[model samples]
Target chain A: MNELLERGPEIPAGTWDHDWISSVVAKAEEYSGRPSHWNGKLYEQPGDVAGVCLPDGSMTISRKHVLDQARPAYTPGETLTSDQQFAAAEATRMAVFQARHSMSEVGDDSLPGATPLESLEDIALENARCDQFSREYSGRIAESMTDQSLPLVAQAPLFPAYSAATDRLLYTLGGPTGLSHRRLGELIDSTERTQRLNAIADEALDHEVGELVPESHRAELREHLTGPLRRGLGGLTMTEMSELTHPGSKHSWGWDSAEWTEVEFSTNLGDIKAHYESWEAEHPGEEPPELPDSLRETFRDREEEIQQVWASKGWPAQQPVVGREQAYYERLPDHGPVTARDQEIAKLQQFLWSHTAPSQHTDSAVDTGGRPDNVRQIGSARKHGRGVE
Target chain B: MDAYREVQRLYAEAMMSAASGDELVAELGETVQRIGDLLPQTAPGERASVLLMNSSLAERLARLPKETR
Candidate 1:
């Protein structure tokens, strides 16, 4: 383990799986030892031959490479009983889940596509690689340095740009560097994350009460959810979005503390509606019974149970709502107040009007000071020295 | 509205109502010669503005959003 994985989120109490952690760390360390050129390619296994470099400059690892690696045999810990081991295994599973959840938060969709254990291993690999790259880069800088500034660091591993000299020259000229690799990468990453988070938040909300929506209205409802509803949720962090949509979340309050309550009530109503709708679907011609007070009371009791969970969890019963409302409306860094698309639409809309409007052909004299004072004076007797009209 | 005016109205409505470039394309059906098809033949003077309109629309449509995973 590299510093990054060592500094990763701590395992919750009693959930630590030492063997699982060791395996992940070993895999990552092994990965880090491999040549940087083999970063994404499959490694040579026991039966595999050396990778052959082809004419077009791509290396073929194996023609008959298996899609998944064989799992190693597990060695149980001596001190722990089966039950304790099971608990540890469960904890390991949750850790992997948390890793996948983190990938989703960062909008690294490809990372989550792999098997759960592979996902954890991949994260470990990423952290190890980052650590390795930074160390190698630091060494390169030390080796190449003659002056205070690093003019030769472009040749270093993961420097992002190839022209450190150009950057240095521009810096000396007191001008901004034309190359903006880090900033551009950050911008692109943040934009992707925003869009993914928006979609996830929208889908979570839909799942929360989607049963209530009529089948006929499903398509329209989808559009609304993905469009304006997604836009509304775009400001929230993924965790906040998750809490808002999750029925069992104790601290569901986002910027608005009461929003969770509203969602909870609506969810209860949605359940009742869903039950009635299901019954109606079952018996096509029968008139459904009026919703009972008992059902409402039952859900209301469930709501109280949720409140008790909140209390037991030691979360504040009510969140501080006043200060955060304005913060809720603040746009994500990637999504500005006004976008290039909006400006384009406004421009094109104006162009459409300008071309189509009949009045546009005959220039309005408004810009020419509304047909000159002399022309206006000609209509009145003022030019001929008449006293008043 | 006249056919040409109606075309202009629909185009304007599409531009205004579209939340995205994809939506705009869907609203306005694929017309390769939009300028020739929609620009009023009678009004030669407005041809430049109509051309500008189509080109601007094309510029906007070209700004495709990055595909989400």
Candidate 2:
């Protein structure tokens, strides 16, 4: 029995001993029914293949050939290549091998005692458990990585580019060498475990969490956690923009009053009004005119326009708009003639006159209302003259 | 294995089990919290040291207190 087991298989001794490359070529040739060449070298048997080759010199039988060949049986203690799947049967074999080894190493006197047969059975069961865990866990990781509703900012790391403004990390995984979803998931799982254990150590160390974790390890953890965390926080909805900008706040996006100042009439007018009233009270002597309802409505309507104007000019919130307003009026260049019943013109003239402090002129009240009848007759005569022409 | 290695092994295995980004993140969070729990309540600098040593773990830990409670 010992001889039978020991002589199970031979590599057919050759110049090369690396098993993997030999197997790859041997398997390729077996599938193709022709000699296989890798980077211009030939491998006739398992033991003749080199471990590594220059990139340009290696070429194998096409992938199609391998699928046609009979699949090899795998047993525990054997490391599979990266492409090999850990099927249930293989997992069972590995489990059994592990159990037997563990039991033998620990010895019969140890708490569990040696029972190779029973240990093998237990291994089978454990493999099943692990398979289920892997299936469920992989599914979950895939779901999180692919969920699109999680905003570009939050999803940036998981996707491709990392944007500070959006708090997103995104990058393309379509290129060569990018892991498939399953493999990438496995990698994520591996890193995640290290992260958790470190967390536990961090808690234990408390004040010494940073000291406990090496700087390099910390950087790795940061790379892994940053994306998921940014995504998670990106899910939060702020009822108030102020909540975003508060000191030490974790939320990256916030409302700037200037951005919404035009629309403040609708959403934040009450707060603004209260603030204005408070300011007015504090400055007691200055009486500002009450904002008329029409003017307020006009201001509200102009919100979009104001935002566009402000954005175009790159004006700060505190910059006066009076110049812009005057420029706008100047562009129009036409205001109807000033005639009788011009209360506005009269008011303006009276204000101007008061400012001049006329020394000799008697302070006489000007009755501008009487000129409206004469102005109406003149307009009628002009229309009659145009009709005659 | 050393405690750090052991803990890291378990953490990596747990992470592999994570099914989604949320789950992965949650698992990361739990791991950080575990570290936090195990951490000694020494000086702030000491606490920071524990976190800084495992910066990834520390970052996850930092995010948790603000988010979970």
Candidate 3:
């Protein structure tokens, strides 16, 4: 048994099956020992085997040789458990359910039949792979000497840009060099954990009551749960998110604290603090939730729960058949005009930005001294100004 | 009354205002109740909400007082 496995996999306790954890770590260590190489760098498994760089600066490889490469067996951890697999599949199915709407939202309905699912699955894979590595190497990786800035904001095209967003969100590669950027990896890991916690928190709320959201409203309800409802829950740490739903949660996605400690924060700690402060400002009399202090912790004082409550709660019974034409409850991430707040927010920002004319030339240097006694006052005109589109 | 918009705004405010421990539970319950009552009286699409709503409705209704109580 590897030394790490003896501690029984350094992962969130209930997020994955024990055997599955064992297999993933064991396999990861095995792959770490593999000798698959192209030139100086190691291949990211067989699928990454592009042709070697030639002297003429061209690259070439036979599709046959690439496929013929003997890659080791690797099962996706996202689909490792049948239930998670089902949920992921259902998530994609739902995305496809609204594929037309998604295409329309993207302003082109001419996508190939399978593009939506394929793109979503790509996103799913990226998320799962990031989740797996983060879980596998949590806290073990080192800090990156490289820049940790978040990727510039992009609209994330319905299906096409899902990947770019996922890539932007991840820091380390899944290769041996992956665990090198400990801080970045930890941040990505925390993010992945945040999503899981969001899902769990969402499950708790959706299942908390006998929700009679009408079928016509089911999609809207689903969108609500995944969106604002998600933002509502996003404030809490992984532990807090879980414990709210599972009061004595024993699960661990690394960081879990109840006070404001600098070390226990995401790479974007300043932003999170600003967000929390803004949230406080936005909700004037409401008490803020308990939150963790650290973004990175080398040690944990895990609460011991002798009894396993893994079976205590589950997600709302999701059905892919709820959608019109049996579409899923919500469109995939890249789908059509989001009837939700996300789309509204985007449009609102665009309107605000377009209307403000921040870049419009102002004769501040010209002074208001003798300026426009009658020389076209900037105020009323700009105020009523039909925007310069 | 654009109940959905109202609910979205209020619900967001409520969540932003929530002081831990599912503080919005009561608000959600009332919102659900009001929407259920009002939507049916509002228009045809609203009427569809009354008929087509699913277990999430039941779940929200069930959850309102159960855990918080």
Residue ranges of candidate 3 with Cα displaced over 4 Å: A1-389, B1-3, B14-25, B37-69
lDDT winner = 1
Interface RMSD for model 3 amounts to 21.3
Order of candidates by lDDT, top first? 1, 2, 3
Misplaced by over 4 Å in model 2 are A1-258, A261-268, A271-292, A301-305, A313-389, B1-69
lDDT of 1 by residue, A140-186 (tens): 32222212222222222111111121122112212111224343222
The docking category that best describes candidate 2 is incorrect
Per-residue alpha-carbon lDDT of model 3 for A253-336, expressed as tens digits?
A: 111211111122221223234434654678755554322333111111110010001101121111110011111112223545
TM-score of the A chain in candidate 2: the value is 0.15
List TM-scores of chain B, every candidate: 0.58, 0.43, 0.42
The runs of at least 3 residues in candidate 1 whose Cα sits more than 4 Å from the true structure, single-residue gaps closed, are: A1-214, A222-232, A237-258, A261-283, A286-389, B1-69
Across B5-53, the per-residue lDDT of candidate 2 in tens digits comes to: 2333233233223133454456655654554443344332122222321
lDDT of 2 by residue, A49-109 (tens): 1011112233211111121111222223444342243222222222221111111111121
Worst 10 residues of 3 chain A by lDDT: A302-311
